[model samples]
Target: FVDVLNTMLDDTLPLTPPEWPEWGNPIESAKDFRTILSYSPYDNVAAKDYPAILAMGGLTDPRVTYWEPAKWIARLRATMRGGGPVLLRTNMGAGHGGASGRFNRLDEVAIVYAFALWAVGMAEKAEV
Candidate 1:
């Protein structure tokens, strides 16, 4: 996988000590632990509504499991009454980490760029 990622970035990816271990390795620092455990995104039933975007992968992810993200997405979908876009772009091939290993996704990136432009436009028009 190093070869794959190196080809894309034209350099090696960093090997920093992960704040959260993906493979259940021993954590060496207090910064590595979340103070809260098992808090779902929509657990606060009395809170005001908020839109969300949930991106996840199904494999190689122990930190944010595929089910957790899916459940969070479902919760947002169930509670979001205003039809906000909870864009869940699943990188199933990329596993628990971010996407890589394809120039074909240039098109996907372009589409996301266009969507962002449109969103900014909508926001601007709403303010005016």
Candidate 2:
């Protein structure tokens, strides 16, 4: 979400001015820009153990470009002390909502559910 600001701050993006109310105008308000940075996940990565993360993104997602997740996962890997793998699954052919077909979305849901189970240590119990 925060990475989108890079584009939002740039005038070339579609809704830069409209986002000022919500995200603050980086160009116009230094205070607001600092505030946004204070809470931005990309900027807050710390050197400590973090929970398992499954950061997924769509290649064609207009809401968030695929690079956002890719960069986030990279930062996590670099800064984290010890944690479960930070996985990234980019849907090369999809957009923000993921694959178009009903069955394909189910498949995506199943993957997310499985990841949740694994994150909570439930997968091993269920496998028995």
Candidate 3:
């Protein structure tokens, strides 16, 4: 979502816009709320055999909740014919703004980035 904004808006929009994009409509350019939720970046995470889902949800966020990602994982987990890691990082302390604690935020970001890299087999994890 941020990637799309940074790409499309480029220099037009400020770092933190006075008013961000509204809720409901979500497609890149299709311009309809119904179409947005049915298909978009959201659907990309849906099962690709044994997809590695980096599902994160802010418990305090009204838009995206811990339950949303949990449900997504439940679907993916159900369809993963091959057993794999579907990392769910639900930050209990985070709002839509994200995690606030210093060390915890560092861990949160690292885990998410690392999980993404690890998911694609681009980075190796050390056995503990």
Best by TM-score, which number? 2
Clashing pairs in 1: none
lDDT of 1 at 33: 25
State residue 95's C-alpha deviation in candidate 1, in Å.
2.0
Model 1 per-residue lDDT tens digits across residues 18-84: 4224422123333322221112243432224554343444454544445555655666777666645
Q: Give the TM-score of candidate 1.
A: 0.47
Query: Lowest lDDT 10-mer window, candidate 1?
Result: 2-11
| Tens-digit lDDT track of model 2 for 1-128 | 64754755777766677778878887888887788778778888899999988988889987778998899899999999998578889999889899879999998889899889978888973552
List the candidate 2 regions with Cα displacement exceeding 4 Å. Answer: 2-5, 125-128
> Which is better, 1 or 2, measured by lDDT?
2
Ranking by lDDT: 2, 3, 1
Q: CA lDDT of 34 in candidate 2?
A: 83
Please give the range of 10 consecutive residues that has the lowest summed lDDT in model 3: 2-11
In angstroms, the error of model 3 at 39 is 0.6
TM-score, each model?
0.47, 0.89, 0.58
- Candidate 3 wrongly placed segments (more than 4 Å): 1-34, 40-48
Write the residue-wise lDDT of candidate 3 on 96-124 in tens digits: 76788798789788887887787778887
